[model samples]
Target: MLHHRPAHTPVRPTPRRARTALVLAVAAAVAGLAACQAASSPPATTSVTPAKAPADRPDRGARDGEAAGHVPDGATVFDDALPALAHLDPALLAALQAAASDAERDGVTFFVNSAWRSAAYQDQLLREAVAQYGSAAEAARWVASADTSSHVTGDAVDLQQTGGSQWVADHGAAYGLCLVYANEPWHVELRPDAVDEGCPEPYADPSQDPRLQE
Candidate 1:
């Protein structure tokens, strides 16, 4: 005799199980979307502060003269664009031009290293000199006070180039350009009497100059 077999019934999830499954599916989809968003987003940035400059370092940009009268390398005495040259005393400028023209004949060009500084610039230089030399007296030998500095008065120039400076040293008297300090061979000043009486002996240094006393 064949036994009758009961048909298998498909098991249906209970209400609680179905609700739990639906909540799990929704949570998984939200997690996937959050991961995708995180992957596509740019990395977070951090803010950084710049380091402060040293207190002892000279501030070259703070001085008005540096902006208006600073002489770049290869600058000629006739560079009208630079206030260093343009602001020079009329007679001194004329003398320099004359000497520069004569120097060109000998294949030497007058390159100005410094000229016509503002009084504030001169004071800054004096402070720097003091710091470098470790004393006010030593600094005075190199840099004069703003009130006494020929640079501040637009009456002095610092020339560069070995050939050009030497040429000026040799023939400067004819043009009334005189080296005022024995220590500074590159520095020159207009001494109108030098054209007639020849250059007076240079002071041993600016310290010994009577003009500096005043």
Candidate 2:
């Protein structure tokens, strides 16, 4: 599913090219087993009390029926360009919020589909993936160890919403956000240099990211 684009692959807007890219990206997201809610896993242990969010965050509470497992509904919120995620990296969250605000002017909204998962949740997810896929080796391609996951450190976010991913794919570099994987278009991370120097080339998947090698 991850079409291996030669390094420095250029993005173009032709309809045929768009369709090809869409097909490949969708396949990659599915095969790579990324995307938060789209790739469901077992429930996490629930916590009655959530850590306090920043004062500047929107004052919203848990909504019924979000797909982020047993985590607090308070973990997710809908704000200008923010997604419903818990424990997002403060800097990344702020940058995303600002980018969302700008995107709204263009009629695009970004929503957080996943963020900051506990190690227990991630382990459970890996276990589930292994069971569903029938092997740890296969599952490893889809899930990472708890400690290595950016989601655990609140440094990564998976998005949802109609055009959010596409918009970010096109304009996010200006805000220091860059798509981290060629297969998982929904996954993004802060790339400070992207704000001025442009986004760097993407890795094909988690396996290729140096941070996950351990």
Candidate 3:
């Protein structure tokens, strides 16, 4: 004879334990989603150079040794025959290059004997001239004060008088160059109007230029 048995059922977890398990499952799902999103995201871009502060920013309009028409550094002697012209005013240099080309066409080679000089160099020259001449007045005739020197400003160039200055003196006016001082035939400056109107009478010397009187 067989005996009847009641159906056996598994016991469910207690309410507290069931709630805890659901909470853990939800938390694990959320964490997994966050990790997947992170893995799919793009990497951040890192710059090699740090951004400069406003005070450390570079001047956009300035170039090496030339800020607002400041004189450039002298070029090395090994560079070119007219290397000194590298330190001269742009307008003056352009005029000189044109004049030199024209002179060369006529079988003359122009040369720059002197161009820009630093303030320190100009001051040293002034001191040497004063010592050699034994008077500031006599020195002033040859070397202008650094404060007023065209060389310091890169506005003047001295050419070899024998050929370069002689050639330029004859033809430079056509290119806007003019001998600037009556006593210094080798010294020239840009006078744009001279291209068509001719150069004005030169000052007697550096001492006579009003810029040097002070």
In order of appearance, the predictions have TM-scores of 0.72, 0.61, 0.61
* Clashing pairs for predicted structure model 3, backbone only: none
**Which order, best to worst by lDDT?**
1, 3, 2
Q: Pick the candidate with the highest TM-score.
A: 1
Write down the lDDT of every candidate, Cα atoms only: 0.88, 0.74, 0.77
Best by lDDT: 1
What is candidate 3's lDDT per residue for 109-195, written digit by digit as tens? 665566877787788789999999999999898899889999888898877665778876778889999998889998889999998
The window of 10 residues in a row where model 1 has the poorest summed lDDT is: 60-69
Better of 1 and 2 by TM-score: 1
> Residue 93 deviation, candidate 2, in Å?
0.3
Residue 17 C-alpha lDDT in model 1: 80
**lDDT per residue as tens, model 2, 88-178:** 7778888888888888899987766677677777788889989998997777667777978888777887777467878888999999999
What pairs collide in candidate 2? 83-112
Clashes of each: 0, 1, 0
lDDT of 2 at 122: 77
* Whole-structure CA lDDT of model 2: 0.74
